[model samples]
Target: MSEVAIIGAGYYGFKPITDEVSFREGTFLAAMRAYEQCNIDPRKDVDSFIACEEDFNVGIAISNEFAVDQLGGVLKPVSTVTSESLIGLASGYMLIKSGLCDIVVVEAHSKASNLVSPEKILEFAMDPVYERFLNFHPNYLASLEARNYMEKRGISNDDLALIIKKNKENGLLNPRASYSITVDLEAVKKSEKIFDPLSEYDIAQYTDAFVVVVLASKEKAEKLSNKPVWIEGLYWCSESSLTPLRGFSTNALELAAQKVYDRTNLNPKYIDFFEIDDRFSYRELMHIEALKVSNKDTIKKDLREGRFSKEGDRIVNASGGYLATGVPLDAGGLARVYEAFLQLRNEAGQMQLKNANRCLIASWRGIPTSTYAVCALSNGA
Candidate 1:
């Protein structure tokens, strides 16, 4: 199979609400920026299109129908992935490697503000017979995991606060980080608790965003882009959706990371930085342990000592991650990838890490589902 490289990318609508633009318009704006960046005519150059979204997310039964023309994919081989964005990227890569397309456009967005009760929608993803009867949102599950993880890993509320403090401060440097604000550990520690150990601010907020990325085969990439970020490997994994069956102490994210590492022959130490799941503060620590970057025993010290910061030995969530940037639903993985792409190419302006050449990104489908996708990228052809 041919290697796939991201040649052009664009992002738009990283806000709490985008009242002026509809979802389709948001996607179109991102698409336009991507086209302009790579100097490609979408209609003529894009051989296929993939839009990552869910029916409930767009508030329309058949959301992909409305997304077709706005993406300049009319009469083209356009399809939708109800899963997260990484899957869409994988699908696009498959299309190109199968000799079906040279250039594939992949898009994902979040119109989270439009949902009347986003929690209710998330609730619907649960098994109605067993889980939905609780009538509480999935945050309860997160709180359960947080409490369980803390007990097993010996992590504390203060440690989680440090993670929040560092990431939020990092967000201050990110233009797209809507939730980025000045915060201190004491302030986070004192915040009101949403669910026991989990606080009201511990959860990552939602934002409106549409991110589009252009992928081309190696041959096309070399001809089209002077700075193409190649996808070294990508894979996603999931535990059973049954919340009762899941072990709160461990998650599928670690399994996903191992698979990607095995596929790419790379690990945490080799990558310059990471953009792992941080929708919940504890999840960041959990994922780190699962990824084998560091364990819970020493991660707190590593985090406090700035090992994961920009000036630290290894950089993590340099884009402020989902905590600061606002989780963009299915777009979450691509959002991280977009940031990695910018950093690898030295285009991430204020948030750019000096001389970062390779990056790893992992995304988790929010609660009630243990699905996670891991991808490794490099500037090398």
Candidate 2:
């Protein structure tokens, strides 16, 4: 297979909601910026485009159409992948590997501002035959999983608070992050409870945002820029769609991680930086265990020891992750990939890791769904 590289990445979103630009406009702005940063003219350089989106989130039947005009995708081969943003990115990579396209643009965005009730949207994701009959709130499902993780792994709510506080503090250094606040364990413990053990702060905040990334074939990447982060390996997996039938604590991320590891010939210890979907505080801990970066029982312990701090050897979520950085739904996964590109290219500014070479990015859909995608990225293509 041919190697694909990320030539440039760009993101656009206000700290909070912004009225200055519409959702499609925000996507275009980011897309244009990324193409320009890579020194590629969209009209001439891009061979195809992949957009990640869902219907209810964008308040439109065909969300991709809203972005096509500004993304320079009109009259170009453009398709919408109704899954996680990184899944769309994985498709773009495969497109290049197939020798079909040399330059592909992947875009994803979320206007959380438009959703009157995101819970309603999430409810639609539940299984209509069995699970939806319970009429349980989405948080209830996440809470059930959290409970199982704690019971089996001996993780405490205090440990979850630490993760929340740490990610929020890390966000303070990230200018693009929406919720950059300083919260201590006590504050997190005292925050209003959303679920039994999960507090409001323990969950990611909804925000309006967009992210765009440009990928090129190895040959094209080498000629366009002196620095390009190679797509070492990419893997995605989905477990039983029926959540009740599967182990709540068993995430598909482990399978995805194993696949990437085998394909890239890399290990968890070799990873210099990482960005994992942390829509819930417990998810950070859950994914850390699934990725095998640390033992399931010791993840919270390692987190408190600062093993995953941005300044630490194994930097995790240096971009503040979805928790502190704001969850833009479909856009959240690409946001993580964009961070990997920046850190690998030495363009992450204050959040940059020292001497970073290899990075891993993992993304997951919300609970009741086992969809996941993991990718390995390196400085060498």
Candidate 3:
């Protein structure tokens, strides 16, 4: 059996606005950087290409068509994943493991600034019969979850604030953190609530970003780079599209985590770090519990004790996560994967962890959906 390894990663335009480069230009640049890092010739060495983007997000019905030439996929097997980009990575992994392709490229991005009405677009994703009729801000969906999570788990506003404080402060070390800021729990607690207890600062700001990752078979990985981050396990899950059937307090992350952990035969104790979703401040705590790293009763304590802080026993979202880095829609998951890649390679610079060996990256497609994905990466062969 051939194991897939992530040999290279490239990123660009994680900004509030990127006036300089168009979406295709950013995609080309990121793809070029990945090819350069892995020493692969896209025109010849690549076997297939997977791009992750929503047609609605890109404002084009057939966005992948415009991407083919730019990504160097010209006549090669090029496809798209409408979900998060990690699904694209999973696609590449399967392609290699099945002995169909030796090297595969995965790309995803966000040009959120280009969206004339982001809310309307998201509203359109809601279930027509159920959620769309409510016609409330999509955050209302998250609010219901947030309130339920808080009451059941005994999570307080201050507990949620701690996450915002830690992540944004941690973002101080991240060059890509567009919304990074320094504030106390009081500030977060006092901020105007968009959906009671879920304050303005509790939500991750949307930004633009482009990420590209290259996955290759074991043979190609060893040949392409001296340090190859192996994909130990990968899984993605989607619960009910109907919000009524979804577990608001407990997200799909647990289901995804269960599969990955079972396949990898590794537990949270083996993970040196984590880069899970923090699109909503409360969701961070909720997800950690769902991932089984800790439970509702204990995670808030762990957080308050600084156990999950950058310098604490368990470091999570050291790149500040989406809370600090800003969410790039479907691209957000790949960004987490990219950050884990940097950490495993000891190339995270100021955000680098000492002797970091294994890590987990998880993501949730925000609001009115229960989509989640998880993948484990190890520096060891």
Candidate 4:
């Protein structure tokens, strides 16, 4: 496979909705910013474009049309992946690896403000036969997963609260984060309950935002930027859609993780930092176990010990993660990778970790459907 690297990255997003701008305007601003940062003329340099989008979120079936001109993909070979943001990223990687394209621009954005009934949109993701009939809130799936984690692995509510507190505190230093506040464990526990075990604070907030990144082959990257974050390995997987039938402790994330790890020949212990899809607070813990970074029983203990803090040895979600940071549907995964790219390049301002080298980024597409993507990035290949 041809080596791929992130030559430049740019993002423009704010908390809540921006009435001053339309969805296309907001996304265009972000794409332009990324192109400027790369210092590459998009019209002349980029060979193709991969846009990540979903129909319901944008109130339009073909959201890619909104981003084409702004991304300098006016008449290029642009493709849309509605599955997940990371899947779109995977498509970009494949395009470059095949030698069909050397420089590819990937963009994803979410103007959740356009959705009149976001919950109704989420319902469409449920299992048509069994789960959708229950009329359960989408969060009930997280609650069920959390409940199973507690019963099968002895995880505690206090553990989930601690994770929330830590991630929020981490967000305080991130200027781009939407919900960067300090909250105590008691405050988290007192928050309104959305599900039996999951509270409102335990879940990520919805926001309108955009994120974009530029990828290039090794030769192109070397000529464009002196500091390039190498894409060592990337993989994605999905498990059975029948969430009710599968064991709560079982997740397909491990399969994706193993695939990336094996391809990169990197060990979990070697990873210096990570940006995981913590759509729910408990997901951070569950993903830690699924990635085999730590045992299920030790997640809470490790979190309390500041093992995952920005200042800790193994920094996790220094950009506040999807939980503390707002979740912008399709753009969430790219945001995580953007943070990783900044950290690896020593460009992350306050949330930067010391001498960061290796980083892992993972994204999950919520419940019922178990879609996951894992990308391994490093300063060196």
TM-score of each: 0.97, 0.96, 0.98, 0.96
Model 1 sits at a Cα RMSD from the real structure of 1.3
What residue runs in model 4 are displaced by over 4 Å at the alpha carbon?
A: 247-250
Give the runs in model 1 whose Cα sits over 4 Å from its true position: 249-251
> How well does candidate 3 match the true structure in TM-score terms?
0.98
Candidate 2 at residue 296, lDDT?
62
lDDT of each: 0.88, 0.84, 0.88, 0.82
lDDT of 4 by residue, 153-201 (tens): 6767777777787788888888777787888778777777768788888
State how far residue 97 of model 3 sits from its true place (Å): 0.4
Candidate 2 lDDT, tens digit per residue, 1-381? 678999988878834575789887898889889988889988878999999988888889987677677788888999989999999999999999999999999999888877888887888888889778877778888888888887887888888877787788888878878787888777777777768778788888887878999999989998987898899999999998887888684458899999999988899998888899888988888888889898866676688798888756667787888777888887778888888888888888888778778899999887757999999999973
Question: On lDDT, who's better, 2 or 3?
Answer: 3
Show the colliding residue pairs in model 3. Answer: none
List, in order, the clash count of every candidate structure. Answer: 0, 0, 0, 0
Q: In model 1, what are the clashing residue pairs, if there are any? A: none
Compute the lDDT for candidate 2.
0.84
Off by over 4 Å in 2: none
Ranking by TM-score: 3, 1, 2, 4
Q: List the residue pairs that clash in candidate 2.
A: none
